[model samples]
Target chain A: MTEPAEPHAHQHESLPVAARVRRLEERVIAAGLTTDAEIDELLTRFYADAAPVNGARIVARAWTDEEYRDRLLADGSAAAAELGFGPQTSGFQLRAVANTPGRHNVIVCTLCSCYPLSLLGPSPSWYRSLAYRSQAVREPRAVLAGFGLDLPATTRIDVWDSTSEIRYLVVPVRPAGTDGLRPDELAALVTRNGLIGTAAV
Target chain B: MKFPPGSRVRARTTDPGHHTRLPRYLRGHTGEVVAVATPEPLPDDVARGVPEPRVEPVYAVRFHGADLWGCETGGHRHG
Candidate 1:
């Protein structure tokens, strides 16, 4: 007996976008513009090692080290390099915005999904969607609420629209009660959403 | 930096028929220069295929939500 059709199975492979991308890569390679190894090396260097955990490690270090926190707030790119995840790979400047009492920071690219990929991994699809790109700047409080984060009215929300080459990283306030936790332990508590300012740590 | 950190400036409203780093929503809106960003090649020139695009410092501007949306809402900083 034949199995029923599963339209969504292998959807990503069968998608038009994937086909177009493959075609483009094939054409470029056929033209001798680039080799497969070159493309794979570029991807491996830029994307393979990228993850939200990299950002968490930075936040964890900041929570544990006062001087490092100051350095991060002063110059984010340099501070990130100190932790081995620098903007050199991304070719974009990194800026860390820390959350404090009565103030919160969120990042959105109104033009496109400009994110610190070297530190935060790939940008979330929602972040790249038009709804999020527009609504995030217009109604951040409501957007944050939809993300299950309801900030008090008194809390000022500062949405950073990354229209330029500079990418933002939100340093969420260290959660209460975890004082004795080590950097690795604190890093475990740091979520991707926390790094994105969608959720707090 | 062309504008100091606290200098108030308005994003030019002139809509050039070419690529630009400034977004439409922020066009013609006034904001405070919060910081000086790295100097970048002018996008308009680069888009026009200028071999040598002029690089200039970009300012980080902070706009109040009340001003951008004409309501007492949240604020944003553009860079």
Candidate 2:
């Protein structure tokens, strides 16, 4: 008779939490602990329900109303509550930092991606890319340039380094010549770079 | 307490982390929160080990073109 296989003996090695988790997951898969289909199904359901809709609406509203826009810049949470959004997920806090003609703003996550999910919605794929993550802090001007955002020689660009505790989003000035457009229409003009303060309205 | 709308608030500079909406340039400086925008759910990865249902509201803040560029000329300055 073959000797009984040791149960999870291979997982006892001393490793970092992240590495350990990855290794254990591999073993579990080898042992058929859970089906891939089940995992995928759970993820699908989780994300489907978890997408940030309320934040998207707030961003949309800001595009339309000048008064509301002013309020959001002052107190992000209160203004969000006024719009009927809140009471979920670590309680919300809103902070708005503006980008001006002479000074530009850029945001980044040094440790990981922490974004303003409420206002800008989910971070774009580029935000998660290593190129963006690394370059954002090292040479922000170059990174912004890659995005086609050009600032005057006299303008100074300020880079905000994001850590594990805080996430930043840029509030680009409302584009010029969009005075009469509807909110939804205006939102369309708000690009990812604009929200990050790399691009102007 | 109720605060007037469009009042500028300075974010505390002590806190540091991944998802801060407050920019470094504005930490000590003050700016008005332009709008009370929308609420957003916290990212699951960050929300872990802290509290359940982490969500934050989004605000639109405006800093004067002058305030940010006061050191340089030709930029808008606060009156």
Error of 1 at B4 (Å): 1.5
Tell me the native contact fraction for each prediction: 0.77, 0.00
All models, RMSD in angstroms: 5.8, 12.6
True contacts kept of 1: 0.77
Off by over 4 Å in 2: A1-42, A49-56, A87-92, A117-122, B1-79
**Model 1 alpha-carbon miss at residue A99, Å:** 0.6
lDDT of 2 by residue, B1-79 (tens): 1224477765557556554444454556565664443545544334454556556544444454346545422221110
Per-residue alpha-carbon lDDT of model 2 for A51-72, expressed as tens digits? 3455445666876777987887
Which candidate's lDDT is highest?
1
C-alpha-based local distance difference test score of model 1? 0.84
Local error of candidate 1 at residue A86 (angstroms): 2.7
Q: In terms of docking quality, how is candidate 2 classified?
A: incorrect
